[model samples]
Target: MSQAALDSLIRMAPVARKSAAEMVVEKLLELIYSGSVKAGDTLPTEQELSAALQVSRPVIREALRGLQILGVVETRQGGRCSVTDLKPSRLAAPLQFLVGLDHDNVEALYEARLTVEGELLALGAARADEAALEHLEHMVHEGHRLTTDPLAFRVMDLEFHHTLMRLAGNPFLERTAQSLYHIGAEVRRVASETPGVLTNSAREHELILEALKLRDPERARRAMHTHLASILRTTREAMQQSP
Candidate 1:
């Protein structure tokens, strides 16, 4: 098929017929994927979009705001809206919020982290540069220095993994990593508070950084697996002890 025809089919694909807000979101996403609205391109004003789509201005604004929150759109002063290169990390806040409200289990978050971080670590080992490796080492060192403070160690741990993801040179992986990291933040906070958890995490960080610096893919993968296993074990034990 011609490229143009393929584009048309994608744009015209059936979307879930849901509430008006959802439909608006779908249509905007279609426009983005079809390149009718490229990144950085200005969207029609709320008034213009309402008129063109035959929807109310308030409806348009609401839909736009939702998209903006999703990192799909950027609204600036003077009411201008532009397309954005939204990343999965942008979903972290909403996902965290929803998961938090639902009393979701940490096991699900751990599963996701294991899968995404394992993949990211492999990619990072293959693609990381001197600068990225140096950053990773620095984060590990900082994490070690803060081993006495579980809270600070947890933050440093998150940064360490995030830096690894950034080194992978894949935006999708980076975003997935961010979401998993965000979801696990609370669990990590509690785990870090446990006696000896921070020290163990710091040691794991050192091992992972050493593997990365060695550029040994297999060792790096093993280090990542070992680190996650420790976390899972500690988290399960902690949950069991909780009243």
Candidate 2:
């Protein structure tokens, strides 16, 4: 860290709080997100951070540990710390853990999925080119063909949504939807056992792809909404029927 950067961080030193380590973590994140420290850049030593932030070295160490677990930073063999690439998978590690912690909150997870995936769908419809539309069409066709094969169909289902997220060109929302989707994986396995569930999902995927083909954002959003609602319903039914 530069002297100027150290001075800036000192100015925003965290006040006493119940979780001082968390506060320190936030401050350090500010430095990362604010572009003061880029990926692969070495973070200041614990002594430097402690002195600059006016916090104890132990607190700084604790904060660094938190960052490491969250995949934000890595400590190399000699105790030097550097920022990670901030890839979606890496950044989403903590969220994936949090989502798994509350298995009963199925509705909450779907609601969040609707918000994130809906936007991604709309953006994909607006921005996808001919090649993207053609690729999605192929995925939809595969969904129909694989309806009888739950395992293969489930993999295609996930890839279909992942394709849309990539089309939206937003890494953050993509990761969020990915995390939310994983939360329902077990429930989806149960739902897939229900005879009509995969068939309906295949049809809904077709509807969504149709809207995307027309390049209609609002229509695409409505299609996505219907598809998600159907999934939620089947998930609830599967949960009720679970042993």
Candidate 3:
């Protein structure tokens, strides 16, 4: 980037509430979103950033490290950093940790799923072609066979949701939905251990598929809500039964 552009991007005023590193991270993100820093572009050197942001080197370092952990940036050999491609899968990596951090988070995660996947499934219903619908049908049939194997059923169950997300043709939402589906894998494994949990989930898959087959977006969304509600109930039961 030109010096003029860098100057514009890096000019920052001191903020009170948050830590300096946190403020730096927010400023850097603003630069990225504002199109001042394109993906794959190497960031300003540590010394340069420290000077430009009027922050200490350690603060800039901490901010960059945090961004690295979030998959927003990558460190090359010799300590140079550049923006990553920022794929949804990479950006959504931290969500796994966030989802299982506390007892209350599980419910909040499902609530998010209901909002995100509901719309994704509705889109899938409206947009899926014959091939997509056929593939989903095959998955539903396979799900029935996997009821005897909880682990395998869970895998298939996740894929069923993934396939639906793909049908929606939104990479961002697909990655988000997939990440959310994976949040409570251990609990879900236990939930699947319930005698009829997998069976019921398979049946719910059938209901979702039926709505998709009819190309009814509203019906598909409703089916997904019902399916997720059932899963959430079993998940809570499994959590209570855990110990």
Candidate 4:
């Protein structure tokens, strides 16, 4: 046999053990990461993959379901599964699962947001174009105007931060920030429900936007830190008060 064929055989060498479903999941992930499968590419039919991988149809279905839950693939009735754009919303289920089982995950999620938003704000200050700046300004004004309605204000608050990340001109950063936003949505809602949190959050947004408008990276960074710190404080207070 040729060297390439020998190598292929080596790669396919038997594992000591793995469940059928687990093997299917691993192979599918390998295909995805190796670029053998690209986003939006429809996967082979269940029957076909089962035959090719020597796994049962039920095992294949189970593996696909697992991937679907992770936002790695989308399945349609009577159609093949397709790779999906990995996104933050995809994290909702897993994040919620962990939050339910491990309370401390909530605090860790907020800390992640603080770190990411701070970097994004500094980048937005240094790189935002005129249009991006206008977008951020609009969100700021909208947030401020909605301060009396805590729920509405919270929505605008999230939008403003997301807009800042968009202004950062980095697709990876924007995606990561959006994912963090989705994961933290519930936490934010709870925080916003607390008395005075909305007002304080809106005020913080104003200062951050001012810094962005001035193109002052230091001020923007500092404002992001303060805003996120307040959010963390409010979140901790809310968690403590929960019955």
Best by lDDT: 3
Deviating ranges (above 4 Å) for candidate 4: 1-22, 38-42, 52-54, 69-71, 76-78, 84-102
Tens-digit lDDT track of model 4 for 1-243 = 133322332355342236877777777777667666677777777876766676678888988888887788897566778888766556344544333412577668767877888888888898988887787778777876786787778667767777788877777667667766676566567778777777787788889989988999889989988987897787677676666
Clashing residue pairs found in predicted model 1: none
Please list the C-alpha lDDT of all candidates, in the order they appear.
0.73, 0.84, 0.86, 0.73
* Candidate 2 RMSD to the real structure: 3.2
lDDT of 2 by residue, 53-98 (tens): 8889999999998899888999887989999988877886646665
The deviation in Å at residue 210 for candidate 2 is 0.9
Q: Give stretches of model 1 more than 4 Å off.
A: 1-18, 85-94, 101-105, 237-243
TM for every model, in the order presented, reads 0.79, 0.81, 0.88, 0.78
Q: Return the top candidate by TM-score.
A: 3
Clashes of each: 0, 0, 0, 1
lDDT of 3 by residue, 113-159 (tens): 99999999999888998998888999999999999998888778877
Give the per-residue lDDT of model 1 (tens digit) for 151-201. Answer: 677677777877887978887778767766676465556777888888888
Q: Root-mean-square deviation of each candidate, in angstroms?
A: 4.8, 3.2, 2.4, 4.5
Model 2 Cα shift for residue 26 (angstroms): 2.0
Deviating ranges (above 4 Å) for candidate 3: 14-18, 54-58, 86-93
